[model samples]
Target: MERRILFTIMLTSFLTPFAGSALNLALPSLGEAYGASPAALGWVLGSFLLAAIVVLLPFGKLADRYGKRRFFIMGNGIFALTSLLAAFAPNLPLLLAARAAQGIGSAMTFATSMSILTLVIPKERRGWAMGWNVAVVYTGLTLGPVAGGFLNYYYGWPSIFIVLAMIGGTAFLAARRFLQEEWYEDTSPHWDKKGAVLYGGAILLIIYGLSQLNSQPLAPGLLLGGLVLFFLFCRYELRQENPLLPITLLQGNLPFSLSCLAALLNYCGTFAASFLLSLYLQSILGMTSRSAGLILLSQPIIMALLSPLMGKLSDKYAPTKLAALGMAVISAGLAGFALTIHNLALWLMIPMLIITGTGFALFAAPNNNAIMSAVEKKHYGLAASLLSSTRLVGQVLSVALMNLILSLSWDGLSLQETLLQNLQLALLFFALLSGLGVIPAKVRQ
Candidate 1:
């Protein structure tokens, strides 16, 4: 059962990132195929993330109240179905809808998988398991670009979706057959409907607003509206006897809160690395997708190699300190990318990627270990969901920032010096954000 659980969770972790990263590499082809504008292409990615962010926490609570294995199997089935939908999409709107459906399914899986692991895995070995879990994530990311590029180059972008569907179908079958045990800590009939609505609505509005700031006319009004509603949601959650999120977990717990904040900042600073670099390589440097993928391979490959070691280290040392050091290293690497990427020799970029990957490997598993360790057993589902939420939020913000910059600085995929300039500014801002992340990571309970 434990091995089955491990395999299921690891496969779930791999597919989500693989889908996202592979899509990033396939975006240029997608644009040509669908005649999507830059903003529209961004939405192809953003729609999925937004959908996941909206439902993740609420679904987490539901999973705890119901049964995790049930949701996991259902999610995998949905994921596979949605991938087939995406592959067959005849238009942009259809494709976007398919991606959104896939996101909802992904939310189901991520919201419960880690919590399930934390419950079943012994306390002493949890770190190692978490490390392997994160390593699988990097492994998926590591392969996404290379595989996606080759697949796109030879078979077209739809092949990516077809391949994803096959993997999802396999996971679905494995979960249904082998993972028979159901884990549910909360059996209460209570479900906070109002809190869930407000939470989901606020996230949707805020992220959509952020993405539209430079491109749309009413961005400020949308942003303000989302913030107002979010504040209301917080206040409402505070008063609920069984809040959807249990605001107290964030408010009263120092280590957990800070760890979440660190995770958020870390993701905001780092998640867009591949998206930005993929464009830089293909659009700016005029490299082929396959060739660019080879270059982009440096970071996640290193991350995949080092994550298990870091996870084991977190078991023996202070995870917070290790995560802090990783943040510092990330700051330095981002700065390097910002300062020298354009003028530096192409080969020199590999070292920068290695440094950045190392920092992330050191940070991810340890930070996740800290967040899960800080929470109690019953709140494991919530903690896991919140952690994943933080990551999705960070990713949304990262892409939002990228789109905003591109909207203001470039148009129609035309190559211009300003494109590089805007990208550099974005990298520098991310470095600054990462530098700030170090503080939260170092904050002790």
Candidate 2:
């Protein structure tokens, strides 16, 4: 019964992220079909990710106020509706709106998923359970391209959304049966309505500002204005009694904070590769969508197979050491792939992507465990949201930084080659920045 309940919670939690990421691989297809410019395309992607994180804090409180299972089902139901709308969207504006709606549901899903787990999972087994949760969380990213590949190859992009809707519907049904209704226990402050508006505004403005990087000339004046808004957001957040993020948690534990940094670094380097490299394989290497998906399968395939064992090992070994080892391996793989990848054989890219994929998978559970374990149980809900927000920020920055580099040095090369060069540099930077996280890892909890 416990396992059934946990599985239901995870399924509800991860369904949106999985679907969103899976749909990402098809962006170029969507762009071409809908005649979207690069800026519009960025917005298409950015809108979803941006809204998901920004809304998390508010929805988290709502989940606490109402029953988690109630909000969980409601969010998934909305996700299914928005996904269906996205499949039928005829114009770019409609698509953008639908994606934003999807993002809201996604944010709700992410916050409540972790909170429900905290409500149910015993602390002693959380480390191991977190491994499976991590694995499930990424299940979409791993399977998405493969599924997108087959669907886009034969069916069309709409099929992907239909599949996601069906999956979400199934999860909703499962939730109703397996989950119990738990009322809120905390006498925490009233939901921070003002905080939500301020945070959401700041994040959207910042993401919009970054999206303007390649499309519009960088206007220092406008960027300064956005920065001002960002600063005000921080000040606003600090004043809230039950802050969206428990800011105090940052100072409480070294391993927890540092582990988040490590994840940011790993994710910054790892996630960018998939985005940039997909273009490389399809345009530069002249491969089919299916072939690109299959070739890229190396990364997630290795992670899926090896991540569980590495997670188990983390039970015995120091998690910090495990993280460091993984990052070192990733650094080596990225550097080698950057230097060596040229007119390569089909079989070659697999080994390089696989090595780093294994590195990332090995690092994930240990890092999440380190972060969650370092914090008190009482703070798990907000802490979980913050951890995800941290990761999303890193991801957004990576995309913006990679694009800025590409635009600066573009010498009339095709988009594919330019994309590769940009990512090569991004990977190097990701590796260097990841080392910074090690400082906090050395401190014992």
Candidate 3:
């Protein structure tokens, strides 16, 4: 049972985030084949995001009601299927649709991974096990860019999906052969359909509004409409006994809100770095696609190597402090990145990349430990649900905001000049956001 759970968790844990981050490196390739406009490209990026956000909490609840193992196995199969579909897609719209289906699979994988980890690991040892789990999650981010670049270049873009599907399929088969059902049916709670819809609507509106940051400001009506829907969603959640993002999750003595804020700001920096830096290297640095991929490799390389070490540390220390320190270091790294823009050498940038990756690795597991560890055992599902949702909010807005900000200064600039100038300015803001997260981490302390 333990081996079964471990294999499934490790596999799906990486797949969910991998699905999202893989596209970053593949975008240039995808654009060439489909001749996609930025907005159309944005939809390709967003399709998985929107689905993951909408279904994450619901799926978490489903795991609690049914069985985590069940969802893990089934969702892996779904992920495998959708990945194959995505690889074979001939048009942009069809590709986006396939990605959207992939999102459902992603949510299922994430929700189940968290639930299974929480339930399977002992309390005394959970922190360490979860730290390891969290490390694997970050490992996905580290692997995706390198893998995406290589596959797209060698085998074409379709190979990305084909490879991911095979991985997911292997995990599914492993789970089926060895995993056992852990849930004993302790009277499942009432399904909060209305609350679920309300929360989903609110989250979607919020993300949509954020995505528009790359475009013109939201019309007064749309902004007003989103705010109203959000307010109503809050009111509805508080009123319901059974809720998706139960108000109690926030209103209780948990550090939920502050932790979420910290996560958002931290991820904003890294996500911005991931999304923008690739274009910058290719365009401004006058590098080929392969070389650009190599340059961008520094960040994730350090991240993958150091995250497991950071995870072990989280088991002993308060995660908030680690998280804050990590953010501070990342801020410094970004500052270095901005300052050294024109010089841009890989070896020269190694220190900054290492620092940034270390900071993120330090911040990632501990923040997760802080959030999940702080919440009640019974609400593990809710807590895990919220974690995935916050990640959604962070990543979705990060890309959109990148577009919005880059468009401001990059208007009519050559791709090289546009990416260089845009990344410089955006990273400064990204640093500021990360630096500000110290306040929340301090509050948690």
Candidate 4:
């Protein structure tokens, strides 16, 4: 059962990043083929993330109420079908819609994968198992751009989706065959409809409002309204006999809350670097998609290599201390990236990538350990959902911020010096944010 679960999760884990990173490299080609603006291209990624954020928590709670195994299998099916839909999308709107559907599928997997793993793995060996799991994630990311570049260069962008569909299908079949266990945290018959609606609505409002700040005049109003709804949702959850999300996990738990915040900050600091760098490599440095992908591979490669060792170290040492150190290293790496606008050399950038990757490897598994360890056994699904949500939120904010910066100065046609300036400015902000995250890590001490 453990081997089956491991294989199932590892396969699904590999599929998500394999699709995401590859799609990032294919964005330029997609733009040309579909006549998409930079903002529109950003949405191609943003739409998917938005959908994930909306469903992650709600579905996680639902999974606990029903059965995780059933939801996991269903999610894999959704993901596979969406991959096919995305591959055949005839227009930009359809493609974005398909991506959103894919996000829902991904949310199903992301929300429960960790919880299920925690259920099966022994407590003492969890760090090692999580390390290996995270390693597969990085391995997928490591391969994504390289494969994406080659596929786009040879066949076309659509082939990426087709290939992703096949991968998802394989995972789905493997899970269905080998995975026999059905784990449920809450077997009693109950579901939190109001909490689910309020949570999803608030997320959509906030994300949509923030994404529209560059264009819409009333975007701030939308954001404020969303915050109000979110507060109301929390109040409602607290009062419920059996809430969708137990408020205590976040409200009373300092370690869990701080760890979540750190995760959000870390992702916000690092996620958009690749998106911006991909553009810089192809447009500014005149590298082909394949060559740029090879360069970008350096980061995740280091991450994949270091994750297990870091996970082992976390088991022996103070995870918060290791996580804080990792965040500090990330800040330094982002600072290095910011410094490179004036002197854009591949040599300098590669070292910075290595620094950030190593830091991320250190931060990810250990931080996950801290969050999961802090929560109760029953709240594993919630913990996993919240952690994944934090990541998705950070990613959305990173992209939205990127779009806002680009919108302020860019005209969407030609690459200019201002784009690099905006990128540098963004990196500076990320470095500051990552450095700020270290405060929370230390506070957990």
Top lDDT hit:
1
**What TM-score does each of the candidates earn?**
0.93, 0.88, 0.90, 0.93
Residues 175-219, model 4: lDDT tens digits: 899778888897656788999999999999999898888778999
Best by TM-score: 1
User: Which candidate, 1 or 3, would have the higher TM-score against the true structure?
Assistant: 1
Weakest 10 consecutive residues, lDDT, candidate 1? 406-415
Q: How accurate locally is residue 57 in candidate 4, as Cα lDDT from 0 to 100?
A: 95
Q: Write the per-residue lDDT of candidate 3 for residues 133-240, one digit (tens) a residue.
A: 766777787678777777877898899899999998998898788676655222446877886786677667767777765464663345567678878877877886
State in Å the error of residue 105, model 2: 0.5
Tell how far residue 96 is off in model 4, in angstroms: 3.0
How many pairs in model 2 have backbone atoms within 3 A of each other, for residues 3 or more apart or on separate chains, i.e. clashes? Answer: 0
- Model 3 alpha-carbon drift over 4 Å, by segment: 28-35, 184-189, 213-223, 342-347, 410-422
Question: Which segments of candidate 4 are over 4 A away from where they belong?
Answer: 28-38, 279-289, 406-417
lDDT of 1 at 157: 96
Tell me how far the alpha carbon of residue 239 in candidate 3 is from the true structure, in angstroms, after superposition: 1.3
lDDT of 1: 0.89
Worst 10 residues of 4 by lDDT: 406-415
Two-way TM-score contest, 1 vs 2, winner: 1
